[model samples]
Structures are given as structure tokens and as C-alpha cells.
Target: MSQKNNKKRPKSRSWRGLFRRRSDPHRAYREKYLETLQYQHRTFDVKGLTTQGIFTLELARVFVDLGLGQMGQRPSTDPIPRFAPAQQRERHSIWEYLTSESLQNHNLAVLGAPGSGKTTLLKHLTLTLASPESLPESVQGMPRMPILLLLRDYAAIIEEEPDFSLLTAVKQELARREENIPLDWLAQDLQNGRCLIMLDGLDEVAKPQLRRQVVAWVERQMQLYRNNRFIITSRPFGYRNNPLNGVLVLEVRPFTPEQVRQFIHNWYLANEIKSAGHDDKGVRLDARQGAEDLLVRLRQTPVLLDMSVNPLLLTMIATVHRYRSSLPGRRVELYEEICEVFLGKRHEARGILYDLTPAQKKRVLQPLAYAMMLHKQREISIEEAMAIIDEPLSRVSPHTPRNEFLRMIENTSGLLVEREVGMLGFAHLTFQEYLTAVHVLDQRLEHELVQHI
Candidate 1:
């Protein structure tokens, strides 16, 4: 009986081992995916593939959990169902241009009117740079992950500088749990010729003076790190030929009506694929119908292309437009309203003040105006703006001193961005426009009132 029991136990143990050895489909897929990525690393001339190493242990876990590598994970059909000829041309042109030797000499400056997908393009470019599959063999040899820094945040940090090294500030930013980025490894990789920086929203930085400083700082850093590249995006108003005078500039043209329709169609298809687990016949038909409607609505303007769906700017526009009627009708008016709001005064009172104190107001508003216009039309330094304003630096304030007028503008709008303690400018092109509108309106009103008197 003991021998029989022992024989049964051995059989049971054998059965258990066999069951454990049976392959897990999901695990096998993950292994294959990782193996493919690893195999690609061999083709690169990388000194050491630390970028892949860090990302494999970090982002891969999250991507796997999200089923990115699963057999049925990607939609059966192309996620983007349609593309216009013009869009194809534009995309191809951009890709070709970036791949050109000019790319090496030029840090990309993407300029577009507001709501023209400038930020989206930058985000897409960053993703492309990060993607293992999309990268060239040479780029794969590099070891650093592309870093996208929002200029507004960077400006804020620089303003609050307490002797912190730039490297330390960058580390804190890269070490977020969501990003799970390895900063030390990244820095080492950068040193090894493996990193790119995508600095977005140059136009969003509130102050013109700070913008110039930021640009100068970036130029200096590029000199320091010859291997790394930068891509900057901004609206045409605040980021023309200022500090980036000699840099490679790419204008983001508004999508043509046909391009707009195609983008809307693509967006609808992507949304449908994301929403539906699989592309059933019904889902395809629904996507087609949605795309048709979206295309029609999006063909009016490049901004409307964004409004056909939810994007950050579209949401802001929708909210603002609901209060007013139409964007075009209210563009200048809304700017004026924003100026009044930023200035903490009613429009009527602001007008009255312009009439009551022309010289004092000109002294205050002109410097701010020149700074805004300079930053908007062309990127100009604060020192240059100061020269234009011709204000004695002593009068611009450091204490409770009476004559410091620019501080008043800074204090009112919270838009004044100081790169260092004493240096300052408006935070964004929108703010610049606001300040510009106030200055222009006040000057016009002062002129009219004087004529009446």
C-alpha cells in the first residue's frame, strides 16, 4: 500500500510539472515583443543601449499591462482611415526637411497661428523620436530618451532659482513616477551622444525678457552639448525672428480645407478604434458616418478642424465662445476683455484712466507695449526693450520706490515672468496681445479725448 501511494504521488507531481511548463500565450507574446526590441538594438552602433534598458524595465511593464503587445491589441485596419493629398505632402515635406542636413544646423522652430495643431505636431515629433520602431538605425545607437519640457514650467523654475544646478532641476522633472525616467542614466546617455530635447510652447512663456534669456540659455547649452537637438513651437506673434534669428524655422501652415476634412476623418477613425474593442462591421459603418459629419464641420478653418473634436485649445475656445458668440467676432474683443481682467479694472474705468493720465499711462504702458510687440512680431531682449522704452534702470524699481512702472504691470496680471529677480517680460503671446490691446486702446482714447478738449 505504501509503494502504491508513493507511485501515485510521483504521477501527480509529474502532472503538476507538465502543467506548469505549458506556455502562457500572453507571456510568450511579451517575450517575443521584448526579443524583437532587443534584436533591433544589435543593428545600432550604440556604445551601450541604456535608453532601451531603462525603458524596457520601466515603460515596458506599463505597456504590457495595457495590452499593447497582445495579438489583437492593435486595430485590424489602419487607425487613420483617410488622408488628403495635401496632408500627405505636408507630412512628407516635414519628414524630409527634418531628415535633411539642415536639421543638424537648425533647432526646429514650428510657428503657426493659434489652434493650428502646433502643440500636437510637437507631441507627435517627440513620440516619433522616442519610438524604437520609428527611429533610424543610427538614432537607435544613441542612448538617451527624448525630453519634452514645457517652457512655462522651465521659466517658472528659473525664476525661483536658489543656486540649484540645471541638472538637478532636470532630474526632479524627469523622475516623476508616471514618466519613471532614469535621469542619471539619461544624463550619461546624453554624454554618450544619445539625447534630444523638445522644448514646447516658447510662445507660452509669459515674459519676453525671460523668453530671450531662455533662448540664450538654450543656445549656450547647445554649444555645450553638441550632439543633442532641440525642437521649439510657438505662435507667430511672439516667436518670429527674435532670439532664434539664425535658427532653422518651419512655419506650420494652416491645414487646407481638404486637409482639415482628412484630419477629421482620421481623428474619428482613431476614436472609434479606441472606443470599440474590435472593428466589427457595425463599428466600421458608425466610424464612416461620424467621419463624414466631422469632415463637413472641420472644413471651414484650421481652428474648426480642432473644434470638430475635443483638444485643449478647443475646450478653452468652446468655453470662451459660449460666453461670447463666435471666435473671429470676439478675437480682438476677447483680448481686450482679458487685458481688463488682467489689469483688474473695468473697460470703462481703464478708458477713463487713459484720458486722465496720458503721460503717466504712456510711461507705464509704452514699455510694456514695446516689450509685447517686440516679443510678438520679433523676439527681442529685455535690454533691447528697455532701450526702446529708454527708462532709467534705476527708476524701474527694486524697493518701495515710486517710479517703478513695469512692476505695476507685473503685479496686476501675474503674467510678468522674471528669468532672474530683476529681469521680466509678459508670460505668453496672449498676454502680450492683451497688453498690446490695452496700450493701443488707451493711446487711441487719449488722442481722441485730447482732440475733443
Candidate 2:
């Protein structure tokens, strides 16, 4: 009986072992319920089946397994090009200016007409300043790495605020690069002399109020970073208030005849070489010769030298010169045609002064007539013109804002350039002749009418 009892006890123990703990139906059900809740939470109904829900479940599982959800992501934009001073020397003289001892105290103002390589020069300068090798020996004592903030990009980032703090904007920009290398640490390494902030395109920023604010901010930044240099480029008139009034202003003169000739020759040679490498050898050689001859002809004009050698301009020049047989005459005709095209068909006899609104027409005629007379006599500045017209600029075409008026003139066949502040001048003497011809044509028309009557 004892042996049977022992055997039963052992059998009972073994059975308990086999069963382990009772599978709690409640707990199991609870777990399943929670899992169903999770599935529901993660899932979405797609036409009766939760495909998106399933995808979410899978993704969640993957994310959970990888432990990767904590890190944030941002939409990517084009990376800023690292500065390379040596390579950009072809485009910007600012590199030379900055490196030179003479320009140390000089605050530069690079002025150029639109598409006159101002942006390219500024971009090159930005890149150069950003490069490691270009860092001045003195900057090694400073604490932060120099930051280049495209004011436009900065404005976009801080859209809520109408008034932006340049210092704060700069700090935020530097913080963004923290992942790369700590700017504070970099600045510490340079002993606070590390950063050279470059603000580009003061003229392109659309709002006048913002421009004024930015200019003030820039002035503050200049004051804050006395060791650092600020370089700016803009079209004339935009800086009428002369934000950097006391700072040394160095203008970017148009490319010299030699510079232009070299650019054209080099461009032609590059094309010739590129064409020759292609399968059509005869065509390439002929093109090369033709380009060389064209380059010779283009070098004769100072204006043509500065202007980009685009196909459209080239074709227009070719057509005009081919018909006229004289470069000067061709240039004059081209300018006139451009004015006519922009001002309308009647511009040659009637003048653009006629196209202005009644009030504007009245305000402009006397000033324009005086400008024409001065232009006929010799080159004159807008300031000089204002003096000749004997009226405040506000009184002259009050309806048309200054920049728009200048743009109107600029777009009118590209002959007139806003040369400097309060200066409107022809791109070349030939263009001046064209304007004079418009005046002459008007006078002749009047004379003929009087005689006919």
C-alpha cells in the first residue's frame, strides 16, 4: 500500500510537471485583446482589407526591432558648395582685394548691371571665404567657423518674423552645421575670430522694408564682428540710402577690353576643341575658324566684351553687322531696334516719353528732352540730369518707382545701364548714338510735317 501510494504521488508530481502552470485563459484573452487593439491602432481599412494597417504593423515591428524612431529627419535641399578661392579667381576680383594689404580697411561695394557677372563674383567670393585654406592666419585665434548665410535663405527659414535678427539667424545657421562640427568649438579654436559671415544679393531681396531691416542688421553684424569682413554686391540706386556710407566703397568696373577678348578667345577655343573631338571633323574646324574671326570682331567694342556671348545676341549682331558692314552702325541699329521692340513700333519717331501715362508723360517729357539734349552733347549722370531738369526725383514720374523705371530702361533693349547711383548711361557710345538718332528722327518728322503743311 505504501509503494502504491509513493507511485501515485510520483505520478501526480510528474503530471503537475507536465501541466506546468494553468494556461490562464483570461490572461491569454487579455493579451490577444491588447494585440487586437494594437493592430487596430496601427491598421487602416483599405476596401474591407487593412493593407495599410498591415503595412503599419510591419513597419512598426521593423522600427521597434531596429530601435530607430527617435532620430528626426528633415527634407533635403542642395548642399552649399564648399569655398575654393583659387578656382574662383577667374570670376571675382574680391579674392584679390581681400588678400591684398591695401584693401584691408576698405569695405567693398560691387556694383554691376544685371547679368554683368555680379552674382557669379559674389558666389565665388562666398565659396573662397568658406574654404579651409583661405582662412586667414588671424582667424585661427577665433572661436567659431565663419558662416555664409544667403540672406534670402535665412529669410525663408525665419518667415514668421518680419524683423529678423542677423545674429540670431547666424547662430541658428551655425547650429544647423553642429552635426558636421561644433561651430562653438570651431570658434573656440579660432578664439572667436573664426567666422566671416557673407550676406549675398542685397538687391534681389524684393521688399524695401525688409531691405532696410537687412541693411540695418548687416550694419549691426559689421559692428559685432569687427575682426570679420563683410562683402556686398548690388545694382546702384538700391543703395541710395548708402547703408555703408562711411565704409570704403570699391566699384566693380566693367571687364576691360583685354579681359573680354581673352574670355571670347578662350570660349571659342574650348568650343573648337570640343567640336573637333566629335565625329564631324570638317564641321568642327570650320566652326573653330568662324568663332575666331567673330571673337576678333567682338573685341572691338568695350560693351560687347563685357556682355555674355550667347547665341541669340551673337546671331543678332551677325545679322545687323552683315547688313550694315560697319560695326558702329550695326551697334546703333541694334540699340534702336531694341528700344523700338520694348517701347513699341512708334518709339523711333514718337519717343518712349509718349508711352508714359498722362501725368507721367508730362513729368518725363521735359527731363527726357533735357537728358536727350545732354546725351546729344555728351555723356551725363542722372544726378546731372536731375539738376538739368531742375526738379526733385520724386516729382519726376512719381507713379513709376525708381527701380521699376530703371528696369524699364534696362529691359528696353539693354543699351542703358544704371551706371552708378543717380546715373543712367548708355552701355556704349554706339548706344548713345542710337538714343540721339531717336531724337533726330523725332525732330526730322516734325520738320517734314511743318514743311508739308
Best by lDDT: 1
* lDDT per residue (tens digit) for residues 164-271 in model 1: 344565555544422333345445545654455667677666466777776766666665655655667665544643447445566544344455445444444444
The 10-residue segment with the lowest total lDDT in model 2:
63-72
lDDT of each: 0.43, 0.42
lDDT, residue 425, candidate 1: 55
- Once fitted onto the true fold, the runs of candidate 1 whose alpha carbons sit more than 4 angstroms away are 1-93, 134-144, 160-166, 178-182, 274-277, 297-453
lDDT of 2 by residue, 1-453 (tens): 001111110001121221233563333332332233233223211121111111211112111000001001211010111223432243434545454444444445554433344444443333333333444563332222334456655544344564566555645654554422222333332233434455666654445676676676667667655555566665444454445753544444334334434444434444444445543667556655655566666766655543433222332344344334456434655654434433333232222223353333223333454355454533456555545434433665555554555444543324445535456655445445455445546555445324533
TM-score: model 1 vs. ground truth:
0.47
Query: Which window of ten consecutive residues has the lowest lDDT sum in model 1?
Result: 62-71
Q: How many backbone clashes does candidate 1 have?
A: 9
Model 1 accuracy (lDDT, Cα):
0.43
